[model samples]
Target: MCVGDGILPPGPLSGAVGGKVKFNTTLSPPTKPFLSVSWTFKGVNIITSTSVNVTSPGHTNRITLDRATGALELRSLVLGDSGEYSVSIIQDGGQQTQGNTTLNVYEDISGASITGSDDVLIEGQSSTNLTCDATGSISTREWMKDGQPLQPSDRVTFFENNRMVSISPVNISDNGQYLCQLSNPFSFAEASYGLAVNYGPGAVTILGPATATVDTLVVLYCSARTFSPAAFTWFFNGLQKDVDEAGYVIEKASYSHSGNYTCRAFNDVIDKHATASYSMQIKGRLAQRDTGSQDRGQQGHQMTPTPTTSRAPGQRAPDAPDTPTTSDAPGQSK
Candidate 1:
């Protein structure tokens, strides 16, 4: 018994251009020595004479097998080289064995970009479209928003070209960083576009601590409510921060991080800004007195060192003597 076309392996069809593609098949010679071996494509003889061989389209050489070993070798492939192929071997008493395999070619997608119907959208507005485009041999496209997959809906229309995915009727809900993916089984490429679907420049609010200690971890959070495509800009001490994400992280914090932290939310199309600011202070421990009279000595007189006094709140204590007094008892230089 021998394995035939009824038991050949399956292969992938899609591939990238200028990339390699291989077609393979396994053959078992029954319990008899083979008389001859040959390969074929589309039912046409690949070689002129009977010999163990492997043939590829558009190649000058026909890969041949060791007459005594019955081995196969194939090299140098192209797009048109993809197709159905078969191998047949002769066994004892004229019995024959054959098998078949399929090959697929693939290419890459490039030049991806983003565009829209209109540059902006107002509150309670109907809709528009956001398009992601590219050029290449991509078989299909995938749409994503903020890294999540988008499905088709009445508000959403997925348009596909040779290398583009356009979402029509875009609404405020569709404002975000959108990514388009083009792919074949062998290669994939992606591009990103940002949407600032503007509605009323939403209200911005600070979500965290109003005061913190020096050198401590602090997170100043800002949230824009009732806004579409919230554009956030964070400021440290009135300077814009370079952090790109929703929040910023500070390590080994110090008093230098303390300032009027501000977050401004806006949409370019709407030409509106909603800003929120938080007063942050990094407090430190109070300094201790070097001497008890150090504070009193600052008042511009020579203060006599006296015992520190404690008084109830709102109660007054006797003032300390300013300096040594000169006096005569009875008759003096009055």
Candidate 2:
């Protein structure tokens, strides 16, 4: 075979499976009006053309030849179609030219998966690592959170050519669904993961009456803001109470019930806790009304009435007037 002027500037070409490609041969101008051209793969004749007719194998129906330019076109390429393709051209008076090209065919991404620890992450206390695993030839990778693109910050980083992601000092806002996408020129695949972040019990509050009277019923409620619902505990005078619910009840408040009432809120996921307390006061039943009674009693003391006594039946009444017929004075006869 004789060498041509030169090969094309782009030496190699690539195509996806079931796609098309073209191999341009730098052919010199033929001196004669008629020329002979042939295309070969690894020294096997794939297509050949003479002045009279053209010939090709039965399976090469998708292959075509340009008689004037000597360029080869391949359609619906397969994995076995990837190889060196050469073209030879002959002119009158023994003039010859040749050119060669390499073709590459790649399969698409078929499947993908994600692998990492699914344990609970603590805010400002835990670290995590994740990896993306894909099948077939993947040329690119992308990461997303809750259907939005993931932007790297000081606490987030990527490694292993963007196949792995690392997170440090995780926070409560980082909880969401994460997606990993792998792609090639022909196909794409994706996988997902659910992330859970545990935070603290903050802003503890107790809701109840500040003051109560004796023999009155009262209920105290406790709550806090947290990622995980907090468990409640009631305390009286620094000692744990018998109740375990979020609400505490005093069936009958007495003077003994007056003390520092405290509520403790705790979260088991992050082992965080918060507390709130109220100095409760219990008063006597008559303490509030007695003040008004004393003020009215002092203003009407001068108008008090004389006291009278009641006598028993059959007994002479005290200071009773004597009848003329039944009684006699000391100076008169009866």
The lDDT per prediction is 0.64, 0.81
Model 1: lDDT to the true structure: 0.64
Those runs of model 2 whose alpha carbons end farther than 4 Å from true positions after fitting are: 1-15, 18-62, 66-106, 118-120, 212-217, 251-256, 270-272, 282-334
RMSD of 1: 13.4
User: Model 1: runs farther than 4 Å from truth?
Assistant: 1-7, 12-22, 29-33, 48-57, 62-73, 123-126, 161-169, 201-334
What is the Å distance of residue 121 in model 2 from its true position?
Answer: 2.7
Per-residue C-alpha lDDT of model 1 across residues 246-300, encoded as one tens digit per residue:
5766665687877787888776666777888888777775676677668766786
TM-score of each model, paired residue for residue: 0.51, 0.63
Candidate 1 positional error at 17, Å: 4.5
Query: How much is the lDDT of residue 270 in candidate 2?
Result: 73
For residues 141-247, write the lDDT of model 2, one tens digit per residue. Answer: 99999999988999999998789999887888888899999987678899998888888788888898888999999899988888888999999999999887889
